[model samples]
Target: MIADQPQQTRDPQAPKGRPTPKRSEAQSQRRSLANSSSKMSRKDATRRQREARRADMARQREALAGGDERYLPARDKGPVRRFARDYVDSRFFVAEFFLPLAVVILVLSMIQAGAMQTYVLLLWMLVILLIVINSVVLGIKLKRQLRKRFPDENLRGVVAYALMRTLQMRRLRLPKPQVKRGERP
Candidate 1:
């Protein structure tokens, strides 16, 4: 038993009871070693890419922090632009709907003021018809204005967006730049 005590070996090879090396084992070992060598080099690739991105962002921020404010020529940012934004946010609603409402209110007040003008009595039907017409016109104008401002946003993942998205046929009702009466697409 004392003689069967473990023997010490410095030159460590594959451990005992491991699978016997096959004929292709040498080739596989060499290939794997080469792969691991190459892979190690690319381990820092992502870090390097992130570093580059950070550097670029830092440069841009530095430029922006300084007085290097670059303006895009086409992107108008003057008083007119501010006015347009304000109009869209508030005044557009007043113009498109409230003005018509105010007109109707004014007409009602005027008629209630006195019957001094005999034209109202004579053309009461005409006046009523005109008010209705003005209301319809105002409604249409308001709808168009709202559509232009907020826009009709289509819900995502519907049949229209998924299947026939390319065919935006809603524009057919609008006045088109028709190629002559007998022209082809």
Candidate 2:
């Protein structure tokens, strides 16, 4: 009789005895929020690792030095500072402004003469002399103006130094090999 009796199955409509594990959106939000901070993000973790490595290296350096600190040598001041001078020598303000104008005038005078005149050499020489003399005077005036503005500053030298530096650049002392020239480790 027992062998012939069929086993009874659990009712399909009955609820499960165990508690369900489903989480609500609010619960998931809370869990993710907590995890976002608790779990070190890749970026933060990498930064922390780098910082630790740097500290370790610094400590190792100090230990190797046996407490003796090494100081780096002072770098050279620029050429501009080394060669600074007073600028704006005021001796030739009129000449500075008039040199160009004088050339223009000389050309016009030559044109007016309409022939190879007797004064050509004189006019040409006059322009050249004016240019040279006025240039010197201009340098002086520039120096004077610089003195007035800066007072304590060496204006003419500064101006000259600045001009020279602007026109030229310091040469590089060494050539760096290109990365592609050797195998990158």
Candidate 3:
């Protein structure tokens, strides 16, 4: 069979008649290629790492502002959380004004006069009552909607998540509100 076959021609680009490299030599070359980053200087590596981190942070910030699910933090991920966020955002909540109301109450409390003290106390009580009433109403309604929209979801922390989002000033809420006030989520 060998004698009957014509001679094969090698390409001009072929190695100059050198024998194949040993298995160890081939493996070492592959390892070096795979880890070529080992040759990078420490400063260069750090700079590259810093740039990558900054880019990631920027993407996360954009996602938070624009409600992009893919880059959101784990706590903010998932359709259930998105729905909860939207449900909280779509309505006006008294809890959203808690900070300003608290500040006003704080300033009022500083007035030491008897009538002002009485007024401040009343205002504080009223604000707290309103917040509690509002939160309860919101929770009840949200629970109903959640049940209707997502019956199979694990709803353990979802209500709390929506309530907490309500507590934040609307302007400061992370994964910023996609639904406008009074809009259906």
Candidate 4:
């Protein structure tokens, strides 16, 4: 009876607790997991980067429109610059008319008459002189005002900045005028 009992067999390559997986099967599982994780992370990073860029652009536009100070560009930031901008915005300057006057003079000079040509030249010279005088007066006044308002602040480029701003048409001014014309700086 003992000799008639059936015998049991086990696979030599398999472990005691589980069957051994094929090398190809193991590699495929790892590759699938890594691909899924990397794709998700890469997509998330791209979305976050896009959001940050959009927020930055919105802030810049707001600053350009004079709506917020936090996003103002480096050149336009600071109290002194703000004051100068306000000062220039609050008044009308004769220099603002220079472009239109020059255009008119150019058209007049194009006429065939000699006398008209001479008159246009003289008019152009006169307009230039007036603009120069106006700029000088504005520079002096702006310097005094800036000194009084920001005594501790550096006045180095404030005058020049203000003068350049004055030369621009009011509507075209960047960091568009926060204060209305005739308003106190």
Candidate 5:
């Protein structure tokens, strides 16, 4: 029977065509291949990371300034926030003038006359009160509108968000106003 089969014999000392790779060696080669696409020095890696971060920030700022919903951050995303922003933007709120009004009051308070200073203080207080009252009213209206528009939305933090947006000068609000003043939301 042994003689009937094709004669196949090998010299034990003869070299095989190629060595079989060890399991560890094969795994290491696979890992190297998988990770070999890019190789950078520490400095280059750091510089690349910084450039990426700066580009991201620039995109974010552009989105905020241009009212580009696609690139807006998580907090500014979604139709509910967009409606809230538009609602606040479409109206003229006294709080929107708070910064400039405060500056005026500060200048007035610096005047030499005691009566002028007293009047400036009163004016400052009056402006603050008006701003607070306006914010409260704006918040109430915004909440009602948001509830009507987005019944299932979480109302938490929305009032504050709308009020804060209202307090910002129209020209300075981030996610810059898409609607002009007096436009319906």
Candidate 6:
């Protein structure tokens, strides 16, 4: 006699196990999911994105001009850097005039008149000497000030940072100078 076989039946309310879906159905599901995430129209989304970018740029510009630390670049962040910037800005340096002096020297060198080249050479040497001397003085002063004010702060690259800042024209420096000339940082 044949043995009576027991048939397995899935419960109607149970989830379907590992069924393969058709391509069209899968595509439809993906479309629905993508649509659900962002309900706004494309134009509206783009407008919002543009506005966000504009707002961010405005904040950064303001930070650069006003010396706001939070929005400043990584290199310019922290009290150590702020102090360095202020220190550089408070005093005049020969390095700041290097660009203008170089332009003047260039024009003078272009003149072929007798002794013009000689004077231009002398001016160049003088300007370079003054800049080197100024940089040395600025470095020494900045190091002393940094040591005094930021005793516990890491001071790596700070002297270089201030020296580089000194090279840039004051009006063009990023995180524009907050302290007036001759003011103590």
Clashing pairs in 6: none
- lDDT string for model 6 (77-134, tens) is 9999999999999988999988988898898899998898898899999999999999
lDDT of 5 by residue, 1-185 (tens): 68789866665555584567789999999999867755566569899999999998999999998978888999999888888888898988888888898888888888899799889988988888888888888878888888888899887787788888987898888998999989998
Q: Please, what is the TM-score per model?
A: 0.20, 0.25, 0.74, 0.70, 0.73, 0.74
Which is the better candidate, 4 or 6, if ranked by lDDT?
Answer: 6
Q: Write the per-residue lDDT of candidate 4 for residues 23-130, one digit (tens) a residue.
A: 999999999988877787889999999999999988898888864778988778899999999989898888888788878888898899979978888898898898
lDDT of each: 0.41, 0.44, 0.89, 0.87, 0.86, 0.90
Model 6 root-mean-square deviation: 6.3
Candidate order by lDDT, decreasing, is 6, 3, 4, 5, 2, 1
Selected candidate, larger lDDT, 2 vs 4: 4
In model 4, which regions exceed 4 Å deviation?
A: 1-51
In terms of lDDT, which candidate is strongest? 6
Worst ten in a row by lDDT for model 1: 159-168
Model 5 score (lDDT): 0.86
TM-score of 6: 0.74
Candidate 5's TM-score: 0.73
Which pairs of residues collide in candidate 4?
A: none
- Model 2: runs farther than 4 Å from truth? 1-117, 154-185
lDDT of 1 by residue, 1-185 (tens): 58888876544454563555886998899898888767756768877998998887675555433312233122222333222222222211222343345566557657644663454454555555654565445445444544564455422222212112112222221112223323321
Q: Which residue pairs come into collision in candidate 3?
A: none
